[model samples]
Target: MKALAALALFLLALHPLSSSAQVAPAYHARAEQLLPLLGKDGGEKDFFSDLFLTAVPVNQWRALTADLRRQYGEPQSLGSVRQNGPTAGQVEVRYRRATVGFTLVIAPEAPNRVIGLQIVGAKQADDSLIKVIDDFEALPGQTAFAIARLTDGGPQWIATRAPDRQMATGSSFKLYVLAELARAVEAGERRWSDVIPLSHKSFSGRLLAYPDRAPMTLHSLATTMIAESDNSAADTLLLALGRENVDATLSRAGHAEADAALPLLTTAEAFALKMPANASLRQSYARASIAQRRAMLRDHAARLDAKAVDIGTVAETPASIDSAEWFASPKDEVALLDWLRRHGGEALPIMAVNPGIAPADAARWKYLGYKGGSEPGVMAMNFLAQAKDGSWYAVTGSWNNPAARLDEPRFVALMTRALNLLAETSR
Candidate 1:
């Protein structure tokens, strides 16, 4: 699910083109139904999308909507709804003092389907920003966190509980993957245009959904891996650049416990390790020699049935998530982002493809790049932005609660505020 987290949102608002056709009554009803679900968990909002235009799976949809939940808390009522083009439109949904808009891309034909929905002009004030961060720190099960602004040479603090402690960071580890690939490109070992074959299909990615033998350029893989946080693309690029190379890159990027996630697991390998039913299999992989890790990963992934590993189902038991998952601290992420600033300019354009921050906040900066990852109990949001003033900043946050399912919307709200706090610094 980390791959799909923050995957929605077009960044650019979908302004309606000229349309003489009336907005369908059913579509209006669907938009009306969608209003109440805006700020809360969006279980019912799933019904708005037309199957023809929006073919995202249910689990993936939830993961993408996590961004909206963070940005838009709850809709009090719709101010108005306007038809955009013949098929899509924008709805003004008010949330407390905030009046956020969302573009709904409706289908051209039957059912007046909703193919897309994304928060528009989402913004927050300086006051509640502190409150949300404070409340999140006081959360009973949340872990140590950090929300600091990394300017030219300062981290004007925003929030922290135990900012130094490391926790499982899920797919946020792909930052190192990108760094290693960049290093490889600099060394002339890989090219952005090099076409590579897809090796394995994994949950939570567009690449896996593509037909077998589809070749993707190294540049395409790098961008999409950050853009959509594509898991298969991450794993594919990881293997191509050599796992050890990525490990070294993490170390270079200042990962405090670089070896903690030693021989960092791919989405395929990590997916297999999460099964409580495969306890023995997990132990064997852990105990296996370093030389045998790849073979072990392939052998295990090949045997695991994809249908059996529903993220919604297996989330109940994080058998190996805590101990076996990727680990990072806010301090470590800040260091990584700093390293990215010095060495990862190539990554900025790709990361900017998904403006995971509030649209209003994002508008304050010349560039904004984000990567967030989550499972059931763990979540991480890391940002690297360059303000219009030509200064850079990084805000990294993680919440780990192995005890129960996380309050994901709450987590997203707090993290979005962290970004808002950074946006304020840009002024």
Candidate 2:
């Protein structure tokens, strides 16, 4: 008899007894009733919690407690009840600071507690936290594209198209050109201040129209080309950098698909590639001479497998065919940004293209860099911003919606929203 009694006591102690155990019958019954509501994997706990905590009125806590006790015996403890704010849901429970608590949210027709009890804080039942939950639940399912929230490094939204989809780049390809130029200057192969004369042949349309035709320094031309989207400066820099050097630099940068032998293309040639058959090729060539037009068309024909004459008067340079399809992924773009951040030392001229930064924020953000590209129906912007917190993020967004031809404005809006979202979440 003594041995049996000792064995029973040992078994009882192994399971232990607590306030929660006192209500074991009711809890188990409630758990069974609520199990179905909890869903197959029991993953809807948080969702149900948010619904219940937000749905119930704070003033009814005492009355609800009384009803609960009358129907299912007294609860072990009501825990802590705290108010967060206007936006977030309020909580009322009997709990101590630092103590774990379980929450069970019950809904009508679901005669069981939908959520299993879980640990919570007395102080965390605040309005702000509730608002966060509400906001998350309220997000729309469809968006323009997959966009990364700059603040928290989280992908905040995904657009209809897969985020990984690649598109033709258009003017954004200029970044590659600028990158090559920067690499040359860094390698001591070229100097920032080195001036290379512009040939009359290189002057057509805009370049031909510029008053300052004297030998322009490489630094001036490079900056103007990238920052202003200056086609003439881009062509000149391309010639200066040489096709071989640019191709080698691109290869080194892991742009294996890029052709080094391709000629520097002009905006006119790029536009002409998409021109309709009915359009006048020579008239569309703008100021390009017959020889320049022939050369441009020849290059375009070679790259796109179409007759150069068909492409018309656009002075087709090597830069013309450098579309977005040069094959870059978001991850690749981010990696390139990281490399530039590390090795693009002392080349402030090339790195100064942020279009949307304010002076004050620029000072606070410390390093604000941006690259944007736009063509008829394509728009893209790549950003590298280092915040005051010593953390940095690299973001790139490319939109290719033929129906929506507003590339620059759209890109600016998307980039701004992403940056702002990042700043908000970082805190």
Candidate 3:
């Protein structure tokens, strides 16, 4: 069982067209025709082709307009059309507050009505890297980001804010698990298709309801763990790989404060230990030395099972996030990604299975690999991208607030803007 994490909106798509048909200049006018319908009541039937209407019904199209209005206010003007092919063009619609760009593909024959439409990107007025940073700072809690260009020597910083400061990573820590898995595969110690039994379960993920000890392939576990943030899949993989090996990955991948993450706790343990009923145990575990804590985990392993987790207690304000949750810095994440990109070639496609951003935004990159994590007061997003110019870059950000919950969408939007800016800058 796998439950998908909502990364970003990927709009509709229709049948593929031939590569030879050149986009006619008239497609620009056709692209402009869509601007007026943003807040309009009717007329979708007149503008869109029958095939387009079949794919995206009138009601769904209207609902899309309503959502756009709510987020960016009413549409005002249209930007220039950039041709993609003989039948397709990209156009930007200027809204009351934000600028939205979408792709329009018209039917190949005469009466070239719209056959495909997909929203590709959106940005606030005067949106820039600095503006994005300012928005991150305006958030109520700690927010940090790092955008770096990877080189043969190492990561060369492009932009950074507290890049080395450790913060709760939530599920982003799975990347390390992935790194260690790749190492084992390359070392001939394990194979991706090797089958392993589900050794642990957690409160989150659809895998929680599955029969315990279900047999699954290593590749499937890693895929669901990274794409769906499936806790059980992650724990099963971690346990199978050996925790000490993953801990070794921490140092090998250039983690600055690896000790803070000593004795990596499985998702089940993290949840169970945060339960209100286990406060005394949690306190004791927090105070113990690294060696002592390892012994404690061994002795109390059963008590930290998913059955012991009280969702109500841990789902409220952050529960010992500083001391309990996985911690990583922006720089550490960049290093981890860089290592994966260079050595984990087999895992690259697994990472790209979910781009974690709008399909249009993701298309700008030659290659984009993503894994993000969020829980209550913590949100983290990390990306390993190859720009169209053949340059490799790493971008990562995290937000944490112990006293209150963080806004995931806001953080996502800001990070999206940063990614879009990076794409534009590199080009």
Q: List the residue pairs that clash in candidate 3.
A: 22-86, 23-85, 23-86
- With a 3 Å backbone cut-off (N, CA, C), the pairs that clash in candidate 1 are 16-84, 39-73, 39-74
Clashes of 3: 3
Every model's TM-score: 0.71, 0.50, 0.84
Candidate 2 C-alpha lDDT tens digits along 1-427: 1211001111111112233333434343443333332222333333343434444333332343343334234233343433221111212333222121233322222222333232221122232323332332233321123333333343333222334444445555566677787787788887778888763222223455666556888777767766676667766666568745654555565443333213334444454444444244424343455355546566544443223325333323222222312335454455555556655664443656644433322343556676666654555667666766766666676655444344243245335545544554443
Segments in model 2 whose C-alpha atoms lie over 4 Å from true places: 1-163, 200-208, 211-213, 256-268, 277-327, 357-364, 425-427
Off by over 4 Å in 3: 1-8, 11-33, 39-74, 81-89, 96-98, 104-117, 209-211
**Residue 413, candidate 1: alpha-carbon lDDT:** 61
For residue 155, give model 1's deviation from the true position in Å. 5.3
> What tens-digit string does per-residue lDDT give for candidate 3 at 215-323?
9999999999998889999999888899889989988988988778777888888988888788898899888887888898899988987776777888878888877
Candidate ranking under lDDT, highest first, comes to 3, 1, 2
Top-TM-score structure, candidate number: 3
